[model samples]
Target: MKKRWYDYLWIASALYLILGFFNILFAWLGLLCFFLPLIISITTGSKAYCNRYCGRGQLFALLGGRFGLSRQHDIPRWMKSKWFRCGFLLFFLVMFGQMLVNTALVFSGARDLGQAVTLLWTFKLPWHWAYHGGVSPWIAQFAFGFYSVMLTSTVLGLVTMALFKPRSWCVYCPMGTMTQLICRAEYRPERKKTAC
Candidate 1:
């Protein structure tokens, strides 16, 4: 098969992680990853982003498929269950909500900027070296929190890739789930009103 331009997105995905590690502000770029999928799904009523344009998915395929890092085991039935996927989506949204709340607090001067990246929503890894003090507290706080979310999800994808198939993380990815939902809603049949 001929490789398309998007096939090289894995390099861009890897670079984003590397750049964000060295410059915390680069984390803001993650918003594109978060929004582009939904926009594509809504406009096209399809999951083209999740199926084709997802850089992280491509990265996992490169690592687990080309590099042979995956065990190639089937993902557990529970992990593929709709209930589990929805639950995970709910949990991910709650974490995102918390991140937004923290950013709002910093913006309001109610809380100081947090300089650490919270991994798995528990471990606070110091990331002060990546952050400079020139930016607004809220902006920097958002960067740190958003970076944590992106890094944590990437770690989960890597782990699942190693344990199961390379694209196993896609089964329950929150963005994938959201985009699926958006596509479904976009194409859902509507009841036509009867004229009086």
Candidate 2:
């Protein structure tokens, strides 16, 4: 079969996911790898991950496109409101906080709810079973909750993109928001023509 751009993206996303799982299960190295693509995505104004690399995004785009629901359009006023942006920012902050707290708990021997939950939901199949066995029950619950939140957020982003332009998530994604700030200050924009 001929390889497409999306195939590479899927592979990259799979790598990230595997690394993330490993980070949660055995080593911090996996966690370090997680930030690499994130940095690339932000600095380059390219969701290299989402566009050509993310498995979930690729799947959604394919399905939505096939169903005639993937075309980009304008965002609805209500969805683009300041309140919505603020809410998304707040949610992103909460996710970051959860990650930090969970990491601390795992390190301090508190509990492994996050890891356990991820494993339970993600590793039910035979292939997944091979990768199971790292987290506590409580941590598993936390992981499942985290996964649900992330999945919901991603779905919402896809819906937003379908309603607006591609990468609607870039507008409010916490990482993208931060990267935009940096780029705005560091990278000068090209001058536009004056109406006068």
Candidate 3:
């Protein structure tokens, strides 16, 4: 498939990962990018963010297709089942809540903000633990939790590409689940209006 100009949005995820190493402020700021698209999805009943702007989704597409890393297989039925998608969504919600709490504590002057601000993949490894010295323990836990998600997604995306389609990960992505909910909510009213 031909790559569109918008496919460059995948770089945002890399940028976010990079920003994570510098300052929590920059990472938090990047959240605005998410919220804006979320709002648009709710209003338009479209997963515009996932399809057009999500960095992770874009990266998955790149690794699976353009990069020629995928095996070009078809996605399994079980993987696309609603149950699997909802489960992933629930898992993400819980983890994201935890990260939010720890980040909030850092913002509230309860933790060393400077220490809390650091890269995503570092500080968790034995050698890099020193990088997080003086930072709140819970904050690192939160960061690690997020990094786990990123790592899991990237790995799964690659695996799916090897076994199934390149975009197959999107079928089970938590972001896609959330966007489906948002778009479905907006869709219900129109269906009701037409039925009436």
Summarize candidate 1's per-residue lDDT along 77-110 as a digit string, tens digits.
9998889999999999999999999999999999
TM-score of each model, paired residue for residue: 0.94, 0.54, 0.69
Best candidate, lDDT:
1
Question: Tens digits of per-residue lDDT for model 3 on 47-149?
Answer: 7777677777777777877888778877878888999899977976786776677667766768643332222333333323324445555555455445544
lDDT of 1 at 50: 81
For lDDT, candidate 2 versus 3, the one ahead is 3
By summed lDDT, the worst window of 10 consecutive residues in model 3 runs over: 113-122
Question: How many pairs collide in each candidate, listed in order?
Answer: 0, 10, 2
Each model's lDDT comes to 0.93, 0.52, 0.65
Candidate 1 collision pairs = none
Cα miss at 106, model 1 (Å)? 0.6
Model 2 segments more than 4 A misplaced: 1-7, 11-34, 41-57, 69-73, 81-83, 112-131, 134-149, 158-171, 191-196
lDDT of 3: 0.65
The TM-score between candidate 3 and the true structure equals 0.69
